[model samples]
Target: MSYQHYRLEELARLVQGELVGQADLCLQGLASLELAEPQHIAFVNADKYVEQAKVSKAGALIVTPELQQQLDTHQNFIVVANPYLAFAILTHVFERKHTQTGIESTAQIHPSAIISESAYIGHYVVVGENCVVGDKTIIQSHSKIDDFVEIGKECFIDSHVTITGEAKIADRVRIHANTVIGSEGFGFAPYQGKWHRIAQLGSVQIGNDVRIGSNCSIDRGALDDTILEHGVIIDNLVQIAHNVKVGANTAIAAKCGIAGSTIIGKNCILAGACGVSGHLSIADNVTLTGMSMVTKSISEPGTYSSGTGALPNAQWKRAVIRFRQLADVPLTQLQKRLDHMQTQIESLESTLKLRK
Candidate 1:
């Protein structure tokens, strides 16, 4: 791996962290606490990992103030308010120094395409008719940008990405490899006992600083654009359907499926494996826990969860049986039992009052 050395003091100053270690110690790269080399920097983000940090052979460590105080070893360390955030900053610094730039000679650009001089088009990349690629944007090898697509400045389109016609991607967007944007949405009408396909005539509009992960399929709308607002982050294997509006800064994790015409509010977090049904509106700041199934609108902002926690096989089977039985019980019978209990309580209260 290509490596660059930075002094412990310099690294700490870059992240505005307090340094407690030897200033002159050079760090080559980042590594996990368990596997850190003598030239590498490691981080302890939580208390659980502090033991690992103590045993690590890293040249320097980045740790939260709390963690640093609790660590048993007197070691070279940078004390940051948030170790995870510091690590993230360092990662960006590392990535920028290593990332490739500049256009390749073998890229196929249409005569009508408007590509900025500063944009990088990789080998075997195809830029279609009337497409506009903004300054400093990088379209990686084997990726296809269809006609009339407008990609803004500083965007990174990874290899094998397919951005279909008329899609608008805003500045600083990062789409990972194998992602398919502006694909036809799932729309069909039943007629004469047969399913007739409906044309997806709209496009996709992705806002600034959005990061979409690998292998994601974001479908175009039927008549309006499927929108992802600024700072939205979508994880791998996500399926965002037609006309869906994912509000600003919302984060949807891996394997999440959001159905057509659903409006997910700002700063919402849909955890991994979550599924939202069609036409639902999830309010701002809502958090759906992992594997939760949302079937209707979420009108309030709060953490939501579904499905039982892991259980032993025999216990799980019994729980499943009881769960099915609960659904089978009549609502009328339940209400009658509740009424009887209320009546008994009232009778007891009356007798107590008489005795008093």
Candidate 2:
């Protein structure tokens, strides 16, 4: 395995940071402050971590301009406005350079499929008829592509993944291992004693820069295509049901399940284990915290949280009992009446003050 080495001056230019160290210093990898070696670079994101930087064995550090005073004078530094962001930029420098492993002989490709000359189709991979695989796209081993599917440029489709239902994926999209795209939605009509199946006729449309993690199931639509706009990131084990439209730049964390026809607006964040019911519209810039269960539509942009955080066992049990007791009471009606009486009393007081 060959690692790419970059000089300090080159890394500084790449991250747009000011280098205050030997320009000729060569770095091979990026590591944490504690684990970094002489050949690797580390980062200090906050002032609180300055003490650790003092003891770190890292050859160089990415630090903000403000932290320069606290950073060790003996250590080399790359100064930037945001140390963490600069560190992220430097990560690309050390990323694995993907060598195009030209199409494997064992791969099965239909004659009608238009696979770019630059694309890499791994062993046992299947490309169906009328499919279009664009430039530099890598479809790893054992992956299956259904008929008429269009995967755009620079996409990465990992091993054992299945893309069916004539899905159209745009540039720079990444579908991790074992994920399924455009699978038939769960549509059924309740008959006398059974469920009659409704054929899912639509497909899926994934925009540019979308990242889908492993084991995710994005169901095809019943009428319209289930869509994921550009810059959308989905974590592992998420279930996106039929006809869902996830807006651009939205991030959905692990174990989330969104039912059919839900439109999640742009810049939204759905934290881990969140569940959104069918037919709900969540406005842009909204955030659903971890373990939240959303049943109603959110019309405004804000951070929303549901479900109780961890509590002591005895207290949680008592809280649960109280909740049950409240369900049995007419507390809502009483509260309304009390609110009306308070309004009346305030009106009387205002009238009395005017007379005085």
The candidate scoring highest on TM-score is 2
> Where is model 1 poorest over a 10-residue stretch in terms of lDDT?
94-103
**Deviation in angstroms for 352 in model 2?**
17
Assess the local accuracy of residue 72 in candidate 2 as a C-alpha lDDT between 0 and 100: 52
Candidate 1 residue lDDT tens string, 1-356: 66778899989999999999699998878999888899999888888887777888887889887888887675789998898899999987666431456668898989999998888899999999999999989898999999999999999999999999499999999999999999999999999999999999999999999999999999999999999999999999999999999999999999999999999999999999999999999999999999999999999999999977899999999999998998999999989999999999999999999999
List candidate 1 segments past 4 Å from native: 96-102, 341-356
Quote the lDDT for 152 in model 2: 99
TM-score of 1: 0.92
Off by over 4 Å in 2: 332-356
Cα lDDT tens digits, model 2, 139-199, are 9999999999999999999999999999999999999999999999999999999999999
**RMSD after Cα superposition, model 2:** 2.9
Worst 10 residues of 2 by lDDT: 68-77
Global Cα RMSD, each model: 2.2, 2.9
Clashing pairs in 1: none
